[model samples]
Target: MPKLKIAASLLAGEFINLERDVKEIEKAGIDLIHLDVMDGHYVPEITFGRQIISTVMKLTKLPIDIHLAVTNIDHTINGFMQLHPRCIFIHPETSYMPIRLLENIAQAEVLPGIAVNPTYPIDSAKNLLEYYGGVCDVLFMSVEPGYGGQPIMHKRLQIAKNLRPFVRGSMWIDGGINPNWAIEAKKNGVDGVVSGTYVFNDVQPMKLNVDSLRGESLSWRTP
Candidate 1:
């Protein structure tokens, strides 16, 4: 099995000093930077836009994965494509034709990803399997979309496991991932773990917490 990677979601980071926070997270050895873009219609929250993402882009060389949690998939898709992020993940619920949108994202030279919320059954995304099973670059399973620090829903993990066979690229677990759950997700065949609160809770230094989480993930011996 491949080693599990960690992506630090910036939603829980210090919003007051985002540039500083990105530097801190990069220093902490996060593999990828996860950005959540919410439009308040899909998840009842409004987050930063391309400007913030552009600012973050100037700060780090790490690959950025932008998760679009908006109701207007077409507008969001067009808006973010201009920013040239490393990867783009759009919720299937929001997109009228997710498979086709995924193709458009791929044509734009950015990795395309399909995101499914915790409440949606894994089978609900089956239409994508036939069309994009091997084509999409990533599959993000969200326990919750808008905010950070939510609890990991065990059912979501099971859903990820169920979808692993069909997912050809990488399988990412988003939402509520911390040191404790990272190991569990890894053991169950998750390719990457997306963490927000666990890395930037302000309860401890962000770097220290990330280091500890990485160590915990490394220590787990899969059976």
Candidate 2:
């Protein structure tokens, strides 16, 4: 198993104090900065556009994992590619040409990732996953997209267990990920997790907040 990587999800960060939050997360030993890019058409929320995401890219030295929670990935992908993020995660259900999009992302020298929602089981994407081969990675949403502060839905994880064989490289789990749930995620074959609210809390030391995600049983102070 690969060493667990923790990504601080900016969807849960304080937007007004983004730079400070980015610095704090990096200081906490975060491996990646997970940026959730939601287009209102796909998910109800509308996160910032290219300028904000570009600003976030400049804020941290850590890699950026941009989750494209939009209905049309093909149309807007080039915009994200221009920013040169470390990786771009797109949902198979949303793409008109998922393989082509993944190919485009890979050709752009960025890791192309496929994000599976809790409602859509990974098993169902087996053919696409298999066909894509080395072109993309996997990201399982332990909770629903669009919103934050959801708990890990164990039943959904159970539903997604069947497609573990198709993972080509890294696998990341997002949404409702905290210390305790991360343990369950690891068991389900996740190499990284996008933890937001728990990690960006105002109560604990940044390092403690990060280390706690490594499966420690510390009481989280609410932000």
Best by TM-score: 2
Candidate 2 RMSD to the correct structure: 1.8
Global lDDT of each candidate:
0.78, 0.81
Cα lDDT of model 1 by residue, 92-115, tens digit: 878788878888888888888888
Give the TM-score of each candidate: 0.90, 0.93
Candidate 1, residue 102: CA error in Å? Answer: 0.3
Across residues 1-223, which tens digit of lDDT does each residue of candidate 2 receive? 5667898888888899899888888788889888889889899999968899899887777888888999767788899988889899998888788888899998999989888887775556778888888856788887889998887787755655566778887778888777777777778777788888888777878788787787554655545
Clashing pairs in 2: none
Clashes of each: 0, 0
The residue ranges of model 1 lying beyond 4 angstroms of the native Cα positions read: 216-223
Worst 10 residues of 1 by lDDT: 214-223
| Model 1 RMSD vs true structure | 3.5
